[model samples]
Target: MSSLDGTVAAPLSPPRPSSRLPRASDQDGSYPRPQMLRGAWADLDGTWSFRNTGDDPAWRTGFPDARDIVVPFPPESPASGIDEPGFHPVVWYARTITRAELDAAGYGGAAPRLLLHFGAVDHRARVWVDGQFIGEHEGGHTPFTLDVTEALGTDPDTAHTLVVRAEDDPHDVTQPRGKQDWHEHPHAIWYRRTTGIWQTVWLEAVPTASIAGLRWTNVDHATMRLTVRLSGERPAGARVRITARWHEGDEDLATVEAVVPVHAHEVEVVVPVARQQNGQAEDELVWSPETPRLVDAVVSLLPAEGPEPLDAVSSYFGVRTVGVDGGAFLLNGRAYDVRSVLNQGYWPESHLAAPSRQALRREVELIKELGFTAARNHQKIEDPRFLYWADRLGLLVWGEAPGAYAFSPLAVQRLVREWMDAVERDASHPSIVTWVPANESWGVQHVATDPAQQAYARSLADVTRALDPTRPVISNDGWEHTNSDIVTVHDYEGDGARLATTYADDAARTALLGGRGPADRRILVGGAVDEGQPVMLTEFGGVDFQPGAKREDGWGYTSAVDDDDWVARITALYDGVRASAFLAGSCWTQLTDTVQETNGLLNADRTPKVPIERIRAAVTGR
Candidate 1:
């Protein structure tokens, strides 16, 4: 195999603080797929060959340039060791896979096939194995995989080259790049860009005919349903074995099992849960932020003739339903008001990537401690690891699709495809109660007047419902909503009394009748207000507080005089949202400071700027 030799560039910059965070255990270590896991896999995440297409055209020659850089971290991130903030339209990555490693990982046999998984790559990605083209994928925030067993030599001791090329267009507003700075340097709201691979990359071995994907749906508190999709060469009379166990805080409560024959490459199985003597569903461990209960699951593919199971995967799920009843947001048949904070998914040093899995958990824990039950992951499809913790810890999430600024055919197609992928990948997690496709007219600005834009918004909501009917879909979050389960608005009124007056019951009615509402000209796009739908002040109260000195050119909705002033303003604004009887919920400006937006409750390093208790009291009114 060709080696990386002369293409290495000089060290660009020193390591940032985020790079110091402990790396996850080796591949096959911390379990990237904690929910649905196979026993053996290889971690291909340490280092890889890197080259910018402009620097060299080695990718055309079927060999990557001899440059070394860390895998998963974007070249623009300080954690990547090559902190070049300049834009590179096309970049390439190459890594070697040894057959010995494959053999040890149970991928040696002729029947077992190797699946290469990429957690994410910005914009578009084209991949190859041993000079043989494999596949290409668009949309950067979702995972995609390729089967590469055919490319590996028949010998189990040879090495194969895997090459990848990613194309990210900073100026292309048609692409969905959430909060990634379009300019050369950091600007008002956008931070540094994430050009290439920004998450984990690994490999797994699966039987030729095995389970491809799973979708979990809770029919009710007592009945759970799962749909298993199969791929590969299926043997006749293949069946699936499913086992579930209820758990509350590590304590096992009950167990249930089911088996169903697979037909037409798909099968749906229902597992009925028993109840205790007190008439409570034993497996009802209904999932919620305050009481996060999960059910451990093991699913196996049972071949007709083999005594041993063909393939078994370990997974977990929560039983819960999120819906809307009248003006109240219902969670599992009860009225629930959302106390949410916006998380832009950015770090001072890591930019779009989290420092570690612990960092992800800490953010959720901090959100819960601050008296918030839900977090709106703004403009970005967050890491799966974050969703894993959200499931285990019981936090509600608004899984939003990153926005594309310009509206075009390319933009619509890309957003739809990527959003569907994002929904499919994270639909099983009970934490994501809602799917938000557009934010504040980022992509569909003409929804109010343009028929096509209005139809597009409605289509997105319809498609989302068709994909996962269990959760609500916010077609266009924060204004001009065409067809949505919830009408969300963003109002950054700094004064509590003014905010209260603006959102008053009479004010809401008057604005609706006048064909416009507060928080920009945001009104029901195609019709009058529907009293049955819930209204949410999804964004408000951005009181800027830079501890040392005031930033003259930084961005925040409103400026605060001091710490005390900031706290008072925040409390006042929240009080307005809390007292508005017409609204079902509200979300604060943000959870942490990102780039030049210094209006977060927490500092850049995730340390609380305002006392946690004080903020908690303001949000929960305790």
Candidate 2:
């Protein structure tokens, strides 16, 4: 067959065996969706037939070239085997799913329906199974699924060809691109682009009537709320059963079942914690960076009269709450000094895609070892697997959305849709303590003056709260805030005494409250006034220091002469931040040194530029 672009379609070749197979056990931390786990699933992270289609739409039906690329890694990354730095707006991927693979994933077992899940695909993606169009999705940073059972036909022995088409315009500034650069070359804060398939792709088998989604809400210290959404057939008199247990023990802490009405597709039930029933202190069961306790849960769908569940999935959550009280950032109703580091979530080898699942777990451990309780995932909707590690390992996270450079109606629509999806996808994770929708006025550039931009900024915060009100929403993270739950400022001043004087006492409060602050931008906009929101120095202390490298080779807010100088500079910065009596929390500029940004506490390869102990002490001031 010949493609419409005057090119003969190449014969589909067998998928090359991937050296990086999915981890065998969920306990080993290879499961892509950590919060929700099903026994019957197959990892699709492997080799695939790849082709750069450029701007040609003709390649959607068939590709004319034969190439190989690794799944879940963008082509711009060295790990993908096609480390092309230049822009290729359109790309295609193809792989064959054999009957053996399907059978191993339980396709003909208890669960018959087959669901193909993509953890994330950049910009836009369209899926086809055996030449039949299955579905399409937009927004690069969130997951989407397609039921391909019918597309694969009823034959259990049949093999199916799965194809994906991704379109990511590098010059399209209206999209929520985050730190992905629009130019051909990386510069300043922006790095290389992640065009397509930067996260996991997997397959799962489920019954016709199955659990589609699960959400856990910490209703109170003593109560937890579970919301279940069903898929396919919603039989009348169906029931959803929920059983929650402590992570360590086999004893069921709470069990609750709710009946689904004839037409109801969703149901919510409250599960009471037994440990906190008798006026016991909520500390034992509550989740925090110190304790890091988790409650594992199994959600099942049952017919009105059946002894067997139609479908089941395992999940986990923590009983915790985050809020701002006066000048304190409260966690579980108690004041907590948030020590956070800005994590860009990029790797030298894999770009936005993590090098491996184990790397994600180590990232969390490294953050904790550095003495920071929280990580602000700056300008990226991180992989859910990373959030799983954070949930298990007890590191707080601030969920943020990628920002668009240009502001337009399309930009507003794209950003809102993606940001909402990001929140809804991660809302169940216990690690996420805050939602940052905009940073430094990236999309809403005129928010400080323009009424429309201000409304947009306010709406982002408002809509995020509407979805998940448990976490505080920073409307604009850095500056030019409107309707923000926390008043956050971004200042890179290096001098310790000067930084202290700038943020001290009533003078700083007056300046910040009156729409003036360190960044020389308005702290409040759209006539919004500070309503006693907890003020935090959210961004500061970007001291560039790369051992055995020239200072001019990399960039940061400030430069350090050597390792000792780096320690002294960071310690002074922390001291200055601590000097501010009204500050509720602080987040340093970065966790790792990115490609050209060498101001990280650790090097890009997860190596500490200075001793880990010194970095911890500087970060914690202890």
lDDT of predicted model 2: 0.83
TM-score against truth, every candidate = 0.92, 0.93
Question: What would the TM-score be for candidate 1 when compared with the true structure?
Answer: 0.92
lDDT of each: 0.78, 0.83
| Clashes per candidate, residues 3 or more apart or on different chains | 2, 0
**Candidate 2 has which clashing residue pairs, if any?**
none
Residue-level lDDT tens digits of model 1 in 1-622: 0101112123222213113222221122256665677667787877888887463444733453467778777888777777788897888888888765676456855337888888899989988887788888889899998998787767776788888889999889989998887899988778889988888888888888877888888777656788888888777888787766665445556666666777768889886654532335532567888777777776777777543566766677887778998877888878898999999888866678786668888888898998899999999999888887888777899999999988889899999999999998999888999999998888888888888888888998899999988888888888888878888888887789987877778566456534666655756876635656888889888778888876766668988777788888888898888767688889998898887888899888988886789888878888
Candidate 1's clash total is 2
Candidate 2: minimum summed lDDT over ten consecutive residues — where?
Answer: 14-23
